[model samples]
Target: MFYWRRVGRIWPVHLVALPLGIYAFYVAAKVDIDWPGLISSVFLVQTWFPDVTPTLPGNPVTWTLSVELLFYALFPLVAPFADRMRTRWLMVATAVGLFGMYLVNWVADATLDPTMARWVMRHPLVYLPEFLLGMTMALALRRGWRLPLHPVVPLAGLFGWTYLYYQERWPFSDVVEHQMEFAMRPMVGVLSALIILAFLQREARGHRGILNNRLLVSLGLWSYSFYLVHHAISRLATYEFGRMPDNNAVLFTLIGMAVVINVICWALFTYVEEPAEKWWRKHTPKRWLDRGGETGGSALPPAPRREAETAPAPV
Candidate 1:
């Protein structure tokens, strides 16, 4: 049931994006794409293979989705155990997850070619610890664990790290292109978990903030569709517009193209992704397993599923 719901929610936009992605490849270069790699992408299994094959033949961004599908497949197995962990164990789990992340990065660095090493580094298993961190945080939040620090601290730290990386101020930036980035995932996960907990705390208390702003929330609603098509849109924009001569011109072009892409993304979400989910939810009956009996009925009102359950599942 969960798997099918995920299919319903994402596959429509994904299917459309795949063809558009092919067009993006074609536009970028007539002979650059590998048909087999594109097929692997269509199945969302490209990341399981080496990066020697075209990693993002269809949709470059969807490589993350391939990793995400792995998480989705594994969640059912992990959730039961994770939910039963006590708050103290949640802290232990976070530490273990971060340790696992470091191990994966070490393994990927030591083993695999540079190209394939990067691929392995981004593989679902390598990043599964981030997912575990998120799950642990959510379970902790449900158990009423309060935030240990101000929300702004983590938020600032998170963005500050990103900004430093962007500005090439990171200490290891010169030594390696991606290993440093991969090494930072545990830190990013920690900050992100704190931010999530803080905002959830705010929501629980009925406090209004930018997280709940109408426009921002609406953008969040279309985020999946935006993710699906943004790469293709950006590629097409670059192909059509070429490079701008100045920084200001580049900024203006990017802003304009972003607005256009968002408008199109809004349409796709309204007309395709949302409708597909609704249709699937309406047509697919509640499973007997979910209902806890063969009769497919329950006395209690259906509980709200977690956002993680329906999230984009991106790494």
Candidate 2:
């Protein structure tokens, strides 16, 4: 079910986006693109290779799909084992994994060439710890763990970190700064988990506020389609018209562009992503879901199947 639903939800928008994006690159403008990179992008495995991706060919941002695809494939396998572990052990393992994530980048930066370092640090496997952190958090919460936290803390910390990084105000030695740079992604994952945990705990306690707004929820449903095309649209804009002058005025241009892109997001989500996913769900073979039944050729054990049922959004 997870695999079936994820494919149905993502592939429709991808099929539409990739060709249009390719045309935008190759036809609308005569930009030179690598065929190998383009092929990898089509299969959404571009990020697995060095030269091919993290340089996304057909659509400039589909490299993320490559990363997420790895997660989708591995999550079900690891999840069964993860579920059997104690919540405390699960969280400890996730923390260790995140530490390993940092260590991998630190080692790569120290030993590898710049190009290889980038590839190593960004390989889809490097991101598995972040996924584990999220998974651990969910399991911990389900097991009734909670800590007193305010949503603003994570948000403010993220803002402060961004300000420090952008302003170069870290007040650290160059070596320390390098390590901090290496640490950013793993650190961001922690902050993001905290932000999610804060809100989920609040909601668990029956709190409700602006986050529950219907408008926001509606926008969330359309968010994946928005993600799919926003980059290509901006890239096309940059191709057609050079970057806006560096000034405060660009912010308003951004706001206007966002409104226009979101209009397309609505149509793409309504006409393509939603309908295709519904059709796939309605038509997918029961054996594919493996309902832990006679029909499935290799059915999952009922215990594991019960723990791994949610169909997470493709994003």
Clashes of each: 0, 0
The alpha-carbon deviation from the true structure for residue 278 of candidate 2, after best TM-score superposition, in angstroms, is 0.4
lDDT tens digits, residues 1-315, model 1? 666667787687898778787888665656466778888888888888875356555788888898889888887677777765565676787789788887777677778677777777777888787777877776656655565465788899888978876776555644465655656878777878888877877776687878878999999998998898888878777788775676666787778888998998899898988888788766666563465443324222333445444232221
lDDT by candidate, in order shown: 0.74, 0.80
In model 1, the Cα lDDT at residue 179 comes to 57
Candidate 2: list runs displaced more than 4 Å: 25-29, 169-172, 288-315
| Model 2: residue 15 alpha-carbon error in angstroms | 1.6
Best model number under lDDT: 2
TM-score of each: 0.85, 0.88
Q: Compute the lDDT of residue 134 as modeled in candidate 1.
A: 75
lDDT of 2: 0.80
